[model samples]
Target: MSGTSDLEFFNTQLRSFVPPGGFDAHAHLYRREDAVDALPRHVEDESGQVGWTAYSRALERWMGDRRPIDGLFFTVPKPALDRPAANRFVAQEVRPLAGSRMLLMIHPDDDPADIEAAAMSSPCVGLKVYHVYASRADTFNAAPGEFLPEWAWELAHEHGWLIMLHLVRVRALADPVNHDYVREHCRRYPNARLLLAHAGRGFCGQHTVEGIEALRGLDNVYFDTAGICESEPLKAILRTFGTRRLLFGTDFSVSEERGRCVSVADGFLWLSEHNVDWELSEFGRPTLIGIESLLALKQACRSARLIDADVERIVCCNARQLLGLRQAATNQTQVTYRRAKRLIPGGTQLLSKRPEMYAPDRWPAYFAEAQGCEVIDLDGHRYCDMTTSGIGSCLLGYADPDVNAAVIRRVELGSMCTLNSPDEKELAEVLIELHPWAEQVRFCRTGGESMAVAVRIARAHTGRDRIAFCGYHGWSDWYLAANLSDS
Candidate 1:
């Protein structure tokens, strides 16, 4: 899928990174070098952490799915014109398109107009303030539990701004001591909605195990899935806060953290491999890669799914809605890579048949289910299906009937039991008879599994973990062993 078709596929269904239910309200990005440092007159550390152009250079190189970046939450640390500089950098240089990329935090200590200027400056959707670590300005302070007053909160709230506040360690959402301020602001200006940075780190931090009951009914409160919390902690926060109130964030410069590292392990490599494979297919070079990381990323998403599709949607949507950027771009070829990513490791799941190498438009042949294989592509062409189904195991068709029927029979017969199914014996006999070279036979499922099992048999027979093959083989020592235990 490419162009508007690709964008449509991504926005509607093809883009799988978005959480299925709500949205990831918070996502931060590092501005490696000021995008617009036209005048280096005022450059400093507290201004902003910088990294990668809009392409997600470092991020995609790590997470495997940099293509879905909709927004970046960041703050102009300190500088006379840092905000203006950064905005110009992003708007004119980094991502000059219909899509949006933004930074929402306010450096309250600076002139307050910069705060409103920040809002009106770019296409940002909200405002963020870490009054303690980032700001700590006395004026924005609200009260006991309140840092920013009701009137101040209302100032940003009236414009439909989603506020992000870092309430250092205040965990109990309802704890009067910590929450009296929030109550005051919510009552005085119920409209000033706030997303607690670390989900009241100290209050609920120790008792995350205490769960949903602690903050069951707070409608205006929100939390970002980041900081001392990640993975399971993130899911818990989502549950306690609900998908609507939970957003996705990596706490800026913290992408080096374990969670960030793990998130990109597969996705980053996928993009790396996809780019290389593409060049290889066109120019005959290759991205030497194994499936472990890709499989790991899949497993990560899979584990999250156990909670509910909504969790996934929230993570994805939060980024999109916050930035107002569509997932798939009208002119991007990358969506093709994202679409075929699920089933294949590095988009192939095969040792040789690298599908990622082809252009997005060229992927139809590899897929057996193109809407029209003959005379339907407008140019009146026919395609010969080329995807090797599980290393030559998919002869009947992709999701074929006869093959599925036989497997279904054995599966229902209890393939794993005290006694093997009669069908297994019959199939083994037929295979041995078919190939006189097969003096011994073993039962296994999946081409990868079968090939690995065959290698084990070969080792037993010839005392070797080595073998040579003629065609595309999966997980057959030369393939599966490539993943190794390290994977």
Candidate 2:
């Protein structure tokens, strides 16, 4: 099933990266008879069937020591395929495989009665809806509602079942219509767990990166690292949703294929031995798509600074929890820190406050409450004032009685309004009186903004564009310009 190069690549590049046992969140299992026509060239099984045995054998060939113990299995969703027979094949194949589950394939127009019967009779965990079932010829551009009808949502909601949606459109998740549909449907059917496959079909990483913001805070929503071969989309998903919501997957059959999807221009393109001349390439021959996907995931985990436990959750624990199976324990602080690295650049707003500046993984990266000189972390561990004290901003020792009373009084009187407060004039008078040489004062919100304003005033008054000063004044453009080579 795999050549010597595949074995070498697995040992050197993917062995340590992949954990002991994984759960493939996305995969297919069916026979040739299930399809209306010949199967795609990517299906490499000579026996004309790809059941649990075939899948296991394929993994053994390339995975070496690490392979998925279970998978979320489904059948090929061709428009003209025999739906009943295909589903029966899937049900039979996965029934005896403990911890493995199957999703019933359905079209928009399918009879709900029949679907209900199949669900009750078999161990079907959810539904697998595809675009090919749409009425239009160009199903790639079909909307989610076109193929996945409202009835499906109702059924899923009523049963609390999951829906593995492979979003398809020109821009995928980046499209506003897709965003609106996902947001509305998710809100409407709160009980139906929506698993966005392929990181919301993020073959083009930009689509996911640009559109992931809209789906944030939707607890029912989740993502699977399926056939995606790039780290950008995975990193974006990890940043938005922690490791618990990001399930590891191998889009098998396709994963067995030798190729990778690359982002090209506004869309994505697939490169395979059939489409390109591997012999003429400067690099070595292409490995399995599965291998490429694993490498990309490892890179994303490294970039996001995910711990071993975080990686374990993505590869094994998350899927188990989603499937109503037992899950491994995880630390909340580590989970939050991983998310912060993805959301906040350098993992913190100020470099001095970064966890790496303290103890990295061992450091408590967040706080639940603060009072006086003591702070309580998420796990309720208390620490007294010993270090920078909130980067010197908390010299008053956090939530001081006088400061708290003054803040409360100001807030009660309305801290902000359409009209300027008379307090500004009084503050200006006090500042000018403190420094007799100053005639007036300009107020700004932060140190960086104040620095920028000061630089502008100095340039305008002196009629000179350049000035020399040192020692990290602020993050203003003028101050940061010192970092440039020509400066």
Local accuracy of candidate 2 as per-residue lDDT tens digits, 401-477 = 58867877898789999999999999999999999999999999998788778878988899877667777765555
Which runs of model 2 end up more than 4 angstroms from their true locations?
35-47, 327-487
lDDT for each residue of candidate 1 in 256-366, tens digit (9 for 90 to 100): 222211222211112332233454455433211111222222333454343444545455654454343544233233344456567656665553555435544454324
The TM-score that candidate 2 achieves is 0.69
Q: For residue 24, what is the lDDT in candidate 2?
A: 93
Candidate 1 similarity to native, TM-score: 0.43
lDDT of each: 0.45, 0.84
Evaluated at residue 111, the lDDT of candidate 2 is 95
List TM-score per model, in order.
0.43, 0.69
Per-residue lDDT value at 243 in model 1: 47
